[model samples]
Target: MINIEWKQPELILLDQTKLPTDIHYIRCTDWRQVAEAIKMLRVRGAPAIGVAAGYGLILAATEATQSNHPFSEQLSQFYEFAEELKETRPTAINLAWAVDRVLTLVKASISDNAITNGEALINLITKEAEEIHREDIALNHAMAKAGATLFEGQSNIRMLTHCNAGALATGGLGTALGVIRELHANGQLERVYADETRPLLQGARLTALELHEDGIPVTLQTDNMAAYAMQQGLIDAIIVGADRITTKGDVANKIGTYGLAVLAKHHNIPFYVAAPYSTFDFTLQDGKDIPIEMRMAEEVWNFHGIQTAPSDIGILNPAFDVTPHELVTAIITEQGVLKPDYEASIAELQSKVQK
Candidate 1:
């Protein structure tokens, strides 16, 4: 379930757009191709996108190094690749976080004169990219463990989730879904309800597929049915993955996630957001500052080239929406779950990391 694979000078991505039926891989030999895959949703999910972007930088550096360009020129090309990859998806903070991390490492290496040769620079970049990938996997596992603790002493926990945050979405198990997997492993999970996320249907096509393959009991419901499901007491809790979590604990996730959080609040169901620390955007004080990506109108008006709505009609297709901090019961990360007073809690966790 490795969605993004780096085989040195080449990157392979699972074609997410054609899932649940056709399994295909898109091979990218250059950074531009990787950027295109991100834009086209070939490699999606916040963590997955970040991992892909890291490898994309490696491809760019490899190409520049193979050209025998000056170290400064190669460095310039790395920045260019970073800019292009960063622009692929606006909602996911992990994309920028990962790119900046690798770029900063390269800059530090140059400043310290630790990388004098092109090959050495390429090797360093590749190693860093691999580290990002490996760390994402480990973080997902840690997040699973931390999140599962919330369900301690509870059995047959029925969880509802939005979008697809499974192995296909990360380098390892997943985020929110990883928690569900842990619950299932412990025999504490009763069933999982997946929302058929509109326009893309990642939950229906990807999430359901992943859970089914893993032999986890799952039920598929349309996005609008969540409220009814909650009313029926079919849902014990709501857990989802985040694209961006601001310093104040506000979250931006798939477009329907905000609505789900609202419903969870009204229904008195706990809402949890699971993600790696990289998904946190410390600079953004609130979710309002997190930019939302608006996708093409055809995604709503048309399905697989078949018109579902009148052509030329107005459509507002935002790829993500923000949920206020108060609506979130907890924010689960690899470190641990952060409770209320999130500004202080998040800062404390980040400081621990810095130390």
Candidate 2:
């Protein structure tokens, strides 16, 4: 099921914060609501957030009128909207990448005098945002096929995944989950182990729900049980989606991904990261430079708004963590599976970069 949809005049989002129980959809007629949803985790996941941010820019553009301000002034307003949305989620590179993509395209069009007024500007942005949504769906499928090939000939393939990298998250089949779907479709999948990502439970609440709804056999386990499960030979491989990937192949994903990678290495299982081209951050040479967003302390100290620990307890709640390139088996992308020397593999990807 598609979690995010554009029904005109409103961007209908399947409120993820209320998942695994109520399938609620929140409508955003204004860009700020979309930005708030990203910040609130009401509409989350890297690709989903990127897709939402694109639509958010459209909403922001729709608010401006050529009669009220000059074209330059309207462009400035659009830039401000883009910056505000980008700030809502700092760890996910897709947020900034998608926003900058749309903005860059519109600016180039205007520079060539193709966009002469507010109406034209809005129309161009609408098409670009819609295209971003469509492209993400296609990328999901492409990456799935590329990633699934790695597990070919291995029947009853058992897989482990963290966070919510399913249709609900990616606006398409998924990244890691898409690969799982492909395996299931090929009659090769035995079972999937999903980690119940803490402080948010995106895996338990979102991944489990999606996999169950799709009739895929899924076994939910707490984040701490991952190593035990691996030691018991309950997991064959670890696959996850990335928030940001650096040029060195270091991955920034959900907070617990690094630990899982370490466990997978010990178990001699493949540790794969699935992501789209847009998720790559070319500016950062190393994952250490990738800014990790520190979340509110209450996210770790409380459960559903009820205090689960001392009220004054100190908490270091980082939303994401980095997995060094040495632990990664390969980086799955739409073009193909990237194997080390990532510099060489990523060269092919960098060739396709526009920005």
Candidate 3:
């Protein structure tokens, strides 16, 4: 196993929007700046966003103390800031989870009266931020092991994946891509087929880059090629990550995921969703309840400042699409591999963890 450390502080992030060329990292200081960076996708990926959100709260708390704000005032400001940060991206539940955790930490510090110095409050929040990062790394390992079981005894697997679901998406390994990585590490993987994932092209850019760098066998194909690949027996399984999984086991992921699920159904291949438990949303009963984030039309009309379509043409680009639980063969989380009966399995897992 390779020991992975967080990127250098100076290299904050490699601006995913400008990949393949112009690899640049933007430096950040203070929490609001980090939140803005995250909103702009200067720093992104589900796990990375969560990690950054933790740091953002720390930065806000530190700034409040420096300004000599009263504890009551700081608390009010912190909640408002946290809410704003949570709204930056709607699909990824980890962003909200991270912010809420940090808010709890801030509240505890103020109520505990264990630290008399205001500076100590800042230090405490920073510690929690680091813990969030550390915990994510541990969770990734657990999720990978549990998810890998889906491929057990299945050799020469030709797995097809969508978007950037590898280490770039999670803390260290990944969700869907992590299982593929585990298979490759064990020499069970034959090849990984990546969907170009239109518009954003996370698969062609990030997924392709990470797999190639790790010496994993991979090929990039357009979103439409998935069905053809499966038809030709080029795909043995379909593995992908999720932005959110409802209580009913319906999954909301990259915009094209629903289509892929339909294709998987026709091909009679097993479709698996790999994600941490944090991605689960018990509040949503089914896919219909998951909020679909509609992005700006400029994303579709413009390609890197070049006009891809006419300015007068209207476009509706949704950040994510939902896949019904019926289309999913299994849902992999740190707790274990769950069948489509998520309501029962998730409730069971939550009860155990809460205990």
The all-Cα superposition gives candidate 3 an RMSD in Å to the true structure of 2.5
Q: What is the C-alpha lDDT of each candidate?
A: 0.91, 0.90, 0.79
| Candidate 3 backbone overlaps, count | 0
Clashes in each model (backbone N, CA, C under 3 Å)? 0, 0, 0
Error of 2 at 111 (Å): 0.8
lDDT of 3 at 21: 65
lDDT, model 2, position 38? 95
TM-score of 3: 0.93
Ordered by lDDT, highest first, the candidates read 1, 2, 3
Off by over 4 Å in 3: 1-11, 115-117
Q: What is the C-alpha lDDT profile of model 3 across 1-355, one tens digit per residue?
A: 1212233232154577777565766655556667777776666666778877877776676666665667667667767777887888887878887888777766776689755555776677677778888887787888888877877787898999998877777667888888888888888899999999988788997889889989998999999888889989999999999888887889989889999899999989999998887787766777888788888888888878899899887698888899998999998888889994778887876676557
Q: Cα RMSD to native, each candidate? A: 1.0, 1.2, 2.5
Per-residue lDDT of 194-256 in model 2, one digit per residue for the tens?
Answer: 999998999999999989988999999999999999999989899999999998999999999
Better of 2 and 3 by TM-score: 2
Instruction: Residues 239-349, candidate 1: write the lDDT tens digits.
Output: 999999998999999999999998998999999999888998888898888899999999999987789999788999999999999999999999999999999999988
TM-score of 2: 0.98
As a TM-score, model 1 comes out at: 0.98
| Model 1 lowest lDDT segment of ten | 62-71
